[model samples]
Target: MSKIDEYIAKRSKQSADFAREYKEESQKLQVAVEVRNLREELGMSQRKFAELVGKPQSTIARIESGKMNVSINVLNEIAVATNQKLTVRFEPVTA
Candidate 1:
């Protein structure tokens, strides 16, 4: 592995709490990126997207900023608003 990859792997194995927190935060950031990308692709601002999703602008801001725990209901609302379906799956994490 590369140096950074090796270091992260070693740290993750040595610190269980750090590994869990890192995984959680990574997932949150990934979702936030996807949300922002979709909104941008649709040429919509956060305010317009929030209105379409029936959520407050602050809620969208929080979600997009990765500062909020997203719920399935909210995700579903966003999907419907964007004419997409929310699909979730589980897969093995590659090191």
Candidate 2:
């Protein structure tokens, strides 16, 4: 491969890794905040909410504690069960 091609490949891999990590962290933070807000607003215990959502109590605890990587679908289920709004947003990067 050309030197420029190699350089581009290296940088692309680094950028991809950074983007993946950032998204994972962002999603986790979002879920944590949403779960806490919904629980408090409803005055519901973790176990109670878990039962309502059909998720494990420990999973709910982990999610609220920022120790779980929650998927968008799972979070949507939580939002639906709790009657709370869980909104996600993204903006294009500016050059």
Give the local distance difference test score of model 2.
Answer: 0.81
How many clashes in each candidate?
Answer: 0, 0
Give the root-mean-square deviation of each candidate in angstroms. 1.3, 7.8
Residue-wise C-alpha lDDT for candidate 2, range 1-95, written one tens digit per residue:
88965765566577988656766776788779878888878888998989999999999999998889888889889978877666888889521
- Candidate 1, 38: how far from true, in Å? 1.0
List where candidate 1 sits over 4 angstroms from the true fold: none
Which predicted model would earn the best TM-score? Answer: 1
User: Lowest lDDT 10-mer window, candidate 2?
Assistant: 4-13
Model 1: per-residue Cα lDDT at residue 32: 89
